[model samples]
Target: MVKYPNGTFAAFRKSVGEPTFKKNQKSNYYRKNINFSDRGMTLEQMINESNKFYRLKEIAVVHKKPTPIQIVKVDYPKRSRAVIKEAYFRQESTTDYNGVYNGYYLDFEAKETKNKTSFPLKNFHEHQIVHLTECLKQKGICFTIIGFTSLNRYFVTPANVIAKAWWTQNKSSVTLTEIEEWSVEIKSGFQPTLPYLEAVDYFIADRKSKNGKYKI
Candidate 1:
């Protein structure tokens, strides 16, 4: 039972009606309020939602790559319930996602960083870097979807730019200024959340204009 600020049950009774639950019966009340201020989705989650929208609209085919893992230990808490207690990666994964868009093979990694000024190079693994480079060699549209969580900004940076920086740059991170120069900015939207295919299209057009080929 609840009472109004005026110390009267009249308002509560009117709002909820009479309680009809008998003794020993369970009663569940509907929640009237929900807070979503701290419920923002992660970068990968946003990308997954976008991929789902794309598939539903027949706009593109994209999927997150599932990492292979070896389950070493399992615990049966109950007869009908089991839990994986220990697992290990079977092998180093190439990238986060892969798909075909506009007859072009798209392979890329999705990453998020909390840093405001730059993205740390340590976020990427050596094998992943090699994989991106190899994909670029096969004329695949390879790139990275980088999200700056602190700034709520996203960019699609080409793999070549990343490779160049990884090898030549002395700095341990890629600055936001450099990303702004080499990458295409992605805008958040309601339908797909992260509209990154637009950035991919931008790269295709830019590459065609420069070399008469969609190599990036």
Candidate 2:
């Protein structure tokens, strides 16, 4: 129970009725992602919500690419009912998502890791690096959304960074310190959820600045 300035115990909230379990404890949000403040939704769900927010505001259009499916056998028990008994997911040739933001072509892969110290390079595939490198060659914005689930931390890491790491024979994973130094941290929120566009803006602007072509 909480006490007011007068030192009286706080009354129960009538709107919520009586307590069912233990009292609620304040969350330490400074160390955790804001959109994950509730610790309920997955990274994909957060990104999807952020995309919806951007679309509603006419900011930029982005979406996850659906994996191609091959239906081998189908059973129709009724005239109006069809059940897919056999199917296989077709092989993918690209990353998880691709679309346009402002004038830049955005392409990325969303990944999650349970490990706390580092993200394993084994989680990334050679084909993904090749595809992203190709996209970069076309002057497109290519990157990744890496989520450390156990730590509840997230980073916007560039594809080239991952590519470079993969090429190093002895390197097996990327450390948290390396990520903090090289990647842009995403600020999660209630409205946009992931709020990743801000990171994209920063990424593009930083690249342009380094290339001596940064403009307003």
Clash number for every model?
A: 0, 0
Worst 10 residues of 1 by lDDT: 21-30
Prediction 2 TM-score vs. true: 0.75
Alpha carbon deviation, residue 96, candidate 2 (Å): 1.0
TM-score of each: 0.78, 0.75
> What is the C-alpha lDDT profile of model 1 across 1-216, one tens digit per residue?
111122222222111112121122111211223211125888888899889999999999999999777777889999899888877777767899999998999999998899999988888776677788778778889999898887777887778766666655465888987777667776566667777888788767756774432246
Question: Which ranges of candidate 2 are over 4 A from the true structure?
Answer: 1-33, 74-85, 211-216
Q: Candidate 2: count the clashes.
A: 0
Tens digits of lDDT, candidate 2, 3-65: 112222123111211112121122122224354735778888889988998889999899999
Q: Residue 139 deviation, candidate 1, in Å?
A: 0.5
Residue 194, model 1, lDDT:
77
lDDT of every predicted structure (CA atoms): 0.72, 0.71
Query: Residue 67 error for model 1, in Å?
Result: 0.9
Residue pairs with backbone overlap in model 1 = none
